[model samples]
Target: MGSTVNMQKQTDKVNLFETQMTMPPTSEKGSSGNVPEDDPSFNPFGFVTDNPSSRSAIQLPETPAEDGNVGQMLYRTEDKGREFGSTIKSGKLRWFVRETGSKESRRGTVVFLHGAPTQSFSYRTVMSEMSEFGFHCYAPDWIGFGFSDKPQPGYGFNYTEKEYHEAFDKLLDTLEINSPFFLVVQGFLVGTYGLTWALKNPSKIEKIAILNTPLTVSSPVPGLFKQLRIPLFGEFTCQNAILAERFIEGGSPYVLKNEKADVYRLPYLSSGGPGFALLETAKKINFGDTLGQIANGFSSGSWDKPTLLAWGIADKYLSQSIAEEFEKQNPQNVKLQLIEGAGHLPQEDWPEKVVAALRSFF
Candidate 1:
């Protein structure tokens, strides 16, 4: 009887996916300046930095380690044909992806974007739930994070915004995930980058949701963000397991058990000890400059696509007011909702709220 009920629910989810894909765009209004032009001077990601040192790739198998802890067990569940662990090459870089769901039903895809420090692993719960609901999901670890390649400053791997953008584009191109799909972005930094991409390729995106992310420059940068960007201190913190664990717990609000936190810690201490790469990415972040440009772009930009701002009130890094203000500035096609009791990592803290928001918003 239990199996029967589960099967019935799966069928219902498949039907729901069919309904969602058939839905029309939020507005017939055409996009204008918001679409990024391929000008020679236009850099989608803010800046470029060069590392004169050489670099090498860590050859991670296309699979999650079977010997992982509880967090890994929870996040890495295989769903027959729906489960995936793969890699896509973008120039000299290789991206790591933990994806699920299927295109067999013809329902659209859903892309999950994670923030700094944390890799695509942040979206494991959300991706699992969404995939179960019958939407194809793709969560890729950024070039420097997760199982992806990590280029040391010694190896000419100066992590830059432009490199991130290019690698992301190349990953999607390699996987052939076009627009008309849902995009869920977490954290302020990744949200700024993802939003810029979405605004440029609005036609490809059916809907977008920003969660616990910095959409406006209203809030001050969290101390954790600042600390992680400090010269030697930042590198030391990222490399030190104890400090890194403390950093994750401080931002999470809810306590993370040692075992679970270890799962989150794995990528940082992976094959080449790439924790410093995260620090490199963090150092390049200038939220004041980045958020200002985003706010300005969205204000005058023409984007009629449906957008949802789902913020976790307990998030210490980003204030809830940023979400509210963002919706106010672009209320015409935007909606703001707060998730109670969840922090910066809402999906980990409150997966149900995150899942429900995605269900309704899309």
Candidate 2:
């Protein structure tokens, strides 16, 4: 918690109504043929032809700096209040920030890390709700899966636990944010980024919330994940276009809504998509080691921070036993909360339950 602050000054606002009167129409509907030379619409002002020799001024919008550092562009939402920012110092890393309410009304900040095949857009609906709850939410789109820059082959798409930890530190520093808040993680990202943040800055973290996330490999991984971990086959499969199509088809069952399957698959359709990143993640991050460290930390009874587990009962990739095992191992540190009628993407399936659980924990 911190002191309340007022809203900052409003930025640029373009007037489309005023500009339309001076601008000439470029084309008309159902006009298939080229315009006649004498037509008024044809080079009416001769601006395009006259400006051919003059270099047009490229107008780049000004992005607000935090701590004197300018954030790279990833994407922007319709509302303009939410924007995605990325950085590529050592590697590609992206984050989504919704700077809507006044600083004084910001109850807390929640940093969300998305899983594979999904980006910050996946949390758009949830972010709206959280923002109303007085939280300045930040959700990062891990490299290779969003508007963030995609690294070429042999350049690694996966983020190691240590790398994510450092990126989070830089993100916070650049944002000039220093406050106790909650960490919300999902899917494989939970292991890479979430666990790293929890371990590195336990004192700063106020609470931990996980949904359908696997911290440990309690059961054998699904064949898809296992296949992605294989050496040559993994690389070949990840880079193959057909495999991405197949993955999209297979992943439909794990999402809450049917339409979401396509949304989740959008990133993989591009070259070097989520499949490539997934393969890299398996190669770089030591899943077993991370899970073991988490288990050890929780079992040692040293962590006093409140932990909440909200797992989708229908999760195809992860099982219920994993949650039970985590609870059994760290009964004193965790509060197991079940989410029914949800699959791998519980936040999409059960946003209410997820928010309710976080409220209780925080």
Candidate 3:
């Protein structure tokens, strides 16, 4: 999974890109409010020094090896049982698996699914916190995001509902993670796919924690996302890297902050980032029937698993009113907890609240 450090560094680079676009190469020092730290091109912020101590609690992992790998090679090597790597079966895709906690202290595992245009990096803080709570957190970067192999256009990317479900099941099997674990999902990742999976295999999920996630078609969908659901224009706009960047920036509250925005942009800067799978997600967005099926499945009482809704009050994409409605509808089954001062990505905005809520549930 991607870390905070990688995101920050990439964001800084993006800021530099913006600077270069606005200023000439031979511009004088501090002309565009850009100042150097270790190198002329490296600026953490416009005027402040880029110091490590000033970074947020979520530290970035060390830079990967020069082989263009995204995570530790040993985690993927055959000697390590190919734990963290890609494997395809039945036309379904499975990605990395990082096993945490010892067998003796294995409280329970958490299968975390991340949101759109992101990989497991979105759950880095949550994963770390869960680890501390003695849960074996098994988070995977989905097939099209993070370190996984990005299939050529038309070969993959536009994944069907069945394909996503099968891929997730295969991933769990590949990693030997059986049932009775908590299912933690966020954003678009869980709305239909994760919820459907949980409904179909309710016995496997102990409890479900949804963080600022939209569960139904009626739930609020961002305007840009709504546009991306269109046909020709949708496909055209989704393919544009600039548009993707803009969407990401708009979704994020810290896009203007140097440290935070950097972390958010790393995976996008990575090869094969946010182009194909994002389009597929948008396409799936317009398929209201599928989302309805998921909602219906949940409403059918198929899921006996305990449900917790930890919503960030400040989330722009998903309105708090939805959470209120959810609680009003499922008063007995769902517990809603509001997280103050957090946006759509609560783990980034308020890690402590996310951690505390999970701890209370788990």
| Top-scoring candidate (TM-score) | 1
Which candidate leads the pack in lDDT? 1
Model 1 C-alpha lDDT versus the unseen true structure: 0.64
Query: All models: lDDT?
Result: 0.64, 0.56, 0.59
Which 10 consecutive residues of model 1 have the lowest summed lDDT? 48-57
TM-score of each: 0.73, 0.67, 0.71
What's the count of clashing pairs in each model shown? 7, 2, 6
- Model 2: colliding residue pairs: 4-104, 5-104
lDDT of 2 by residue, 21-67 (tens): 32324343125343455664554433211211111111111111111
Clashing pairs in 1: 53-155, 53-156, 54-155, 55-155, 179-204, 180-204, 188-214
Question: Is 1 or 2 the stronger prediction by lDDT?
Answer: 1
Residues 1-362 of candidate 1 have per-residue lDDT tens digits of 12221111211011222222333332421242222335544433211010001001011111122234434333543221123667767777877888888865356799988776666766777888888887899888777776778887557457776666766778888888765788888864554678777767778888888887777777667676687777778766676533344454456554443344445556544433557776777787777877876676656346678888888887877778888788877788889888886778777677778899988887
**Candidate 3 lDDT (Cα, 0 to 1):** 0.59
lDDT of 2 at 145: 59
